[model samples]
Target: MTLTLTQTAAEAVKQIVARVPQAEDGGVRIRDTGAPSGFELSVAPDPEPQDTIVVTDGARVFLDEVAAASLEDRILDAELAQDGSVRFALGSQV
Candidate 1:
């Protein structure tokens, strides 16, 4: 199983990565923070050697080892606030 991203989420990620000039070839990276959500999102110019890369609609998302396992059966969704903030949510893949 592998982590998946909704089209909305992909677009959101694409938008984020577009803002980072250095991350042109990069995208959004999801890491295991071991916190409440046990996850964090950031712009990564490149992926770690062990990272799991998932690309959807030309949007690339890098999932760290722990995050990859944790989200393998999950789907990532996103919502953009009026202020241009991105809110990400994880849901079971159906």
Candidate 2:
């Protein structure tokens, strides 16, 4: 499975990770929530046994088996809204 992050997203994640206390040994985890058919992202101390690790330029993203498959051909992107809030976008690899 493959998961990618845009330059903007990578930069944003890197900045957030840097501020985390144990970021050096931890990474971000992305999980699929079957109930509502959505995903959740958070910082994790480490990847779980069944996680699929995606290493980007400046950050590491850990995805569980289901999440990895769900995002196999997707790209994670970040954008700044008019209100100055950060928004996350998921797109097809094409």
Candidate 3:
């Protein structure tokens, strides 16, 4: 299984990637951080060799091996605030 994203999440990622310097190949990246949620989100200029890449509406998401396995059955959603902050949520795939 692979990861998936809601349209809002995809757009948020696209906007983030667009603002980064020298990030033509960049996208949002997710990794397991051993925290309670075990997830860490960030932007990467490129995917690592072992990443799972998911693209939607031209937006890209890079998932590390651990995160890929964990999120494979989930969907990503996002909310963008007027202050330019983004909140991401994960839900079980319907």
Candidate 4:
């Protein structure tokens, strides 16, 4: 029901928000794919060419049709890598 954003994650999201004109929502939605293996994010199917994870600064973090059911508890955390890379942690909604 509630999700927490790590400082790095928040900064990343904020940076993304600054770039995109549509991401005025100011939050990211994380969704789970119904697949037995993993999850994806979005309100629609994954795009072609590359199946890489897609993230945006949109106010809403959409859950792909398949991802919605896989994830229940939602917590967004970030880790500042030694190289300054940001890592995100996704967990149950509990």
Best model number under lDDT: 1
Report the lDDT tens digits of candidate 3 across residue range 3-91.
78899999999988888888867998899996896688888999999999999999999999989998988999999999988899989
Q: Against the hidden reference, what TM-scores do the models get?
A: 0.94, 0.84, 0.93, 0.44
- Candidate 2 RMSD computed on C-alpha atoms after optimal superposition onto the true structure: 2.2
Better of 1 and 2 by TM-score: 1
> What lDDT is obtained when candidate 4 is compared to the true structure?
0.47
- The alpha-carbon RMSD values of the candidates against the true structure, listed in the order shown, are 1.0, 2.2, 1.1, 7.3
Q: After superposition, how far is residue 5 of candidate 3 from its true place, in Å?
A: 0.5
Model 2 clash count equals: 0
- Candidate 3's C-alpha lDDT? 0.90
Which window of ten consecutive residues has the lowest lDDT sum in model 1? 33-42
Tell me, by TM-score, which candidate is best.
1
Per-residue C-alpha lDDT of model 2 across residues 8-91, encoded as one tens digit per residue: 887767666666888666777899987575998888878999999888885788999889999998999998566645677899
lDDT of 4 at 52: 24
Give the count of colliding residue pairs in each prediction.
0, 0, 0, 11
Q: Is candidate 3 or candidate 4 better by lDDT?
A: 3
Better of 2 and 3 by TM-score: 3
